[model samples]
Target: MVCCSLENNDVGWFSRRQSAYQCTTPITASQSCGGLLARIRPTILQIPPIHAPSFMALRRDTLVEAVEFPIHLESIERYFTMTDRRECAFCASEITEINDSKEHVIPNSIGGRKKVRGFICITCNSSFGQSWDAKLAEQLNWFSLAVGIEREQGSCPAKIVHTVDGTELRLRADGTMTRKEPFFQKTESDGKVNIRMLASTKREAQQRLKGIKKEHPGFDLEGELKNLERTAFKVNSALQHRLELGGSEAGRSVVKTAIAQCVRLGIAAHRCEIGIYTLKTPTDDRGFALFYIRDVVIDRPQTDLFHLVSIRGDSEKGTLLAYVEYFGAMRVMVNLSSKFEGDSFISVYAFNPQSREELNLSVNWDIPATELHAAFNGFGLDANNFYLACRNATAIAYHMQKMRERHHVHREELSAVLSQLGIPPGGIPEPKDRDQFNSLMEEKLGSLSEFIKKIPPMPDD
Candidate 1:
């Protein structure tokens, strides 16, 4: 039997020979040996294919192919060729027809060519246009290309190292040195002993050593650490500081102030009212003075009608009189008396003749003595005789009550009128409360009712 051995040229020949020659056989000079030699020679002589081409060759080939190759122009050249064409990049529909504008994949202003290979239709472009930028688009394309290259060939073991400035250093993929200053620098009075660390890479480590020699003019080589703790600490500290202070409360306070000032200036009136009074509850021995304000009203205009200014007196003596006024030439004076601690009573009569008589005429129904007392206690009604203080401590309260009742009935009617249309309800909390409910309201609706109201409806064509 004839025997032959073949080995890979790329791998060390010795290692392949050792692994291949486990069994030994005698070689004979004969016709069979010639046949075996012929078969083995062909197998050993054939050159292995080169998987990775040199950079220079690749660049040369790309340029030559790009120039020599005949590019098949797409059928929709009219849409893609013109940089300023107002047609949709995707569908080739006229921008005016679609009521939109053509968008560039790479924005023209940023050194990006006007004509882009990838063009999206107006609808698709508009959706992307809302939030995308050229930098992001470029980064996405670069990442995709990198992934493709990595998949074609397994990852290469190439590394770079460098000693950047005392603060930070980046070793690029190709042998290059990048130095970044420390965000914060700490120093001692005793001469500046600059501290720097080097990344472990062949290209950068050699370059960094040379740089250190150049910088120091003549410095001895220092031992390297397996872990760069000082450099890592500095970097981590810088990152922490950036994360903490960047766009933090200090940064957002200015925005908050601007919004608050804008709301205060833009809104027509101060939609708020304050009431101060003394209450004599049965549980308490003496009446205590209290201060309270009505809930904030966003839309309603403030009216001074039957608004109480102040209350002063003892609850037991019934000497408490509330000084109050109404919007139009109306004033009231009320005397409150409590027979029992729990049960208080008040007699509401106009201070003047015309007002009292008008109020008496207006209130035809027999007023409950306790209710009148509670009304005076809760809201100063006798401040103006003609106007008996009505529901809640709001002038709009009467209108609001009527509106609320009508709201239920008008809900269906208004709903029918507003079907498919987004008219927000009239009631929304004032701007002061908006911050509290911003997340809730923003989740349910695109914006708060108050904010939506500020934006005028689109004009009918």
Candidate 2:
């Protein structure tokens, strides 16, 4: 009689002896070992047949291979070692040193500085970065440029916009605009041709004049170039900006961030069934992601532009959810999974998009899993809540815009103050004059604070 003591909860593995095989009663299938067996079926099939007492005998008549107990245990141990290797949460590819890459829980492109390891392989990271993440970043670049969002990798991206008057503008990161192409308007007044040239740079203006030189051989291109005056042009008219928020590509990107947040919280990507499914399939307007439904208040300062992500798991209700707000402008909720079997947890991350400064944030959503499902399907009063949230977000964004304008004005005022202190505008004082400069700055800098009080109220206010 070979006595094999293989009693365990998840998997049963027999101990090895040098001389003979000792076999005890096999672990019962009622202890969840059956599920373990199913998972390791491929490994089990690779074992060579040995004429001995069955180690996994569910019945007394079931006689199977267990001739070499030590060899069998080694094989099971090797299989488990391979199975325990880290894999990408999205693609399930093994994460080796060659393939391991830091994944930002929020995308670095959109001012997301938080990063985690062992959650994704480099290949999947690159693929998502090019597809969904790229699109989402492009969609939010306008707001990023406006708010001067701090990024871990690079500066905010510039975007091309077409004004209502058919002027193509390249919006810069510092809230400045330039024409996409060198443009000149020709107007005739009182028998004289007045050419108005608007070029992005002096080089461009010179190039434009060179082209005009070909039109008239006698024209003094060099002379007119020397007389070129530089002036600032501001668009006073209303410029329409249309921001289309959600679709397949952008939706997948949002879900990716949500999944990364879950992975950061020690939840495996495979457990996020809905999130993975959404990433795999093509999504439409009614996808797994939706505009945030539950009532939420923007308690942060109105002038602060923030990017926020919140993840929560309800073990009793078997629901896992993620909430994301981009630049306090667009908000989305992702139903990560409905079969979550983890302990209840809530995690939040918030940061000023401009400063990349982390904020201590608390987020709570008492809404049930059923309501979340219904919210995704556009049921009940979710539409009302969504509208209200959007309105509030817009109000905050508008306030931020006004504040940004005031900030620019304050810079000019500071320059004037510097000139009054016998220092050239934008010039640093000499080392010898530093003592006097410091005293003057302290005396006059308080006036700069007055600009904040003059900022206009929000549009809704």
Candidate 3:
């Protein structure tokens, strides 16, 4: 994580501050670790003035050695923020504000917000319900179930897959899950014991109920067994039916998933400057189920609700990009159509039925776009992991283009800068070359002449 400012006291000292730091000494502790700290303890502050102070004296050696530093400051003037009604991040259509409009960043089906602090015009919002958001939810169906998140009742219905015997079937929340067990008794038979299982479902029980008369006309068994086994089966069926998880026939409501995403990326920004990135959900078997859904019977079980949503943004990164991380596990990124303006962390709206709390964190956007970046101190998000894991020339081409266009530079110029960076072209570097690649990319981004201060976006409201 890097906090950039050209306001050092020793301004116009070295070619770039990065070079000055490279020339300084090493230390065990970081300058930015503990917040509310006004200064690095002086004991460890001997490294250099290049760090620590917003202003400092240039080392005589640095002033005498490196080439002349640029005379410009990297301060941004505008800050991008989200608004009530704005353009769609997906369709590029204008979204008008209305009384009923609500955008869920994670989507209502996945236990996301119903009224996130931003908006995704109703049109594009609806389209996403029919398309992108739905597919995203589909991709994460298992995790959602494991997390015990619920879907909005009506328009955004849950797609539940239940396995019976060897077959997999899709189900909506309106009906019940039925399983039958057949119980029959035989009085002292020919030195043998018999066991039978009854109806696995209501329909099957009703269908199988007709056979008691034909099969046992001569047997006389009163007590609870007096009735045809079918009658007893019906009673068991009523008690055994498993009602769906998220109640049935929920009211029709607009989902706010994409809008929540927009808020996370600072939708207050202008549309065109934001960048969007989508990553494939990881498929692996690890950890145990977050919550278990079972039959609601005697000693009733409490459904543990784990519906949490967080919208983290980096407004200082110039381009507003969203990073969706599910706890410390799953992650996704959506670049809004705008630029972020200042240092901001994640704005979390956690819906825990057991507790109520509020949280705010601050993060720097100038940090390296590493695959292991975490939004907050313990967010456990690697925003670029999956994106880089499956990196191809085309996956990042659009954002690269946006970066190029934003700088008003040609590809060759960018390549030349990248080359001088000592970082190889493209972003992938083999494991053995990881450290080298990181150093090079840092150099490339740090020393570019055309790389001016990042500009934040302005709100449309």
Candidate 4:
């Protein structure tokens, strides 16, 4: 028989047995326990307790994808090492330590969150903190691009008509004239006047009246009537020509088609004026198409002014389209408001959704800088001065760095450099009085450096 006992010390309890088979050595509790266990049937061996398997692996897989903050060990490590305690991503000022908080590479308001990765910095995060739902960067980019394209194209062609009682005149070819008369009537009144007037052209009638005027200085009645007829004829002719050129069916059709395309692309149309008898229809996406018809005949004279029309359209689908209705009749003119006169061409910007930002991607057709400067003058800002200052800043920075290595410092030389940059003699601020300017330059450089650091290392490929 085997006995089993529990013990608290190093020496185990021993069984009280002395025989040829019994050993005299102290039997450890383990040994006693083993003997007892051995006495049990071999088929019924004792077994150790079992524990439940860990679910940590499954939990990690389930949570990593959905959690916005650092969820996995690798990400957490990266957060601490790369972004946690960085400076403001945009402004580049050190504020917190790395690992203090997760910086959003993209701001949350613009559909960016911690899960998206590598878009936000601490300062930018705070600046845009909780201010989500601002216009998406993509939309801004699109708008900027659209505005630029339109500005470059100048104003779209429009058909305008102005009509006066018993007369209609149209201005065409920038300035041309055509005359059409429905009827001509001469009535004789038996007053104290006994004079017959007949001439081949209106100019001949005027010449005849001028001779009569010299003989009878006070005989202004015939001259006044002749002047009236000439004026009416000229006005009528001008109006007819304009209508023939601008208010034609073909012109209307071209405009209609262009407008339809703009509408489909989600662009807005402003001040669109088609010729009379033009056909127009709405676009599926939300715009209009116009068709010019020249079938209508107008005996009366009229004049028209096709003013600027503002167009808005969808950029993603390329909605806006422009074509010459009458190639010769259409002329694009950019109005120079006093402020923007010198700016011959304005910059257009487009919003990029992928970059989540706006970029000035293109310029209107090349315009002279002088024109743009004149344009800006209307705005009460000294554009020339501003331009010179900007140019000087760049020149100064470049030359200062170039001369630094040579250890040459000359105010006169610097002033000459400023002049080359278009700055007047006294435009540049003195170095001793330029603390703010220096700080601004340093801040800009710092931001650029920080931005470079945030860029991911290039891949081998």
The prediction achieving the highest lDDT against the true structure is: 2
Stretch of 10 with least lDDT, candidate 3: 4-13
**If ranked by TM-score, best first, what sequence of candidates would result?**
2, 3, 1, 4
Candidate 4, 128-173: lDDT as tens digits: 4223212222211111221111212232121222332233322111
Q: What Cα-based lDDT does every candidate model obtain?
A: 0.24, 0.56, 0.31, 0.25
lDDT of candidate model 4 versus the reference: 0.25
Which ranges in model 4 have alpha carbons more than 4 Å from their true place?
1-193, 196-204, 209-306, 309-315, 321-461
Q: Candidate order by lDDT, highest to lowest?
A: 2, 3, 4, 1
lDDT of 2 by residue, 1-461 (tens): 00111111111111111111221222121101111111111012121233232212222122122121111110000001123457886678888888987788788788888887676788877876457888888777767765666676667776776544555566556554556766677777997666767676556777878887887677788777655543234443323344556567877788888877776666667777667777776743333445544534345545566788888766566666777888765677776666665467677888886677898866766654344444364432233333334434544553454466446545644554466556777788889777877775564344334434433355432
Residue 137, candidate 4: alpha-carbon lDDT = 24
- Supply candidate 3's per-residue lDDT for 436: 64
Q: What global local distance difference test value does model 1 have? A: 0.24
Per-residue lDDT tens digits of candidate 3, residues 148-200?
A: 34465643343433222222222222221122223344454686433243443
TM-score of each: 0.16, 0.63, 0.37, 0.15
lDDT of 1 at 220: 58
Residue-by-residue lDDT tens digits, candidate 1, 231-270? 1111211100000110112211211111112122221001
Clashing pairs in 1: 161-204, 331-383, 331-384, 332-382, 332-383, 332-384
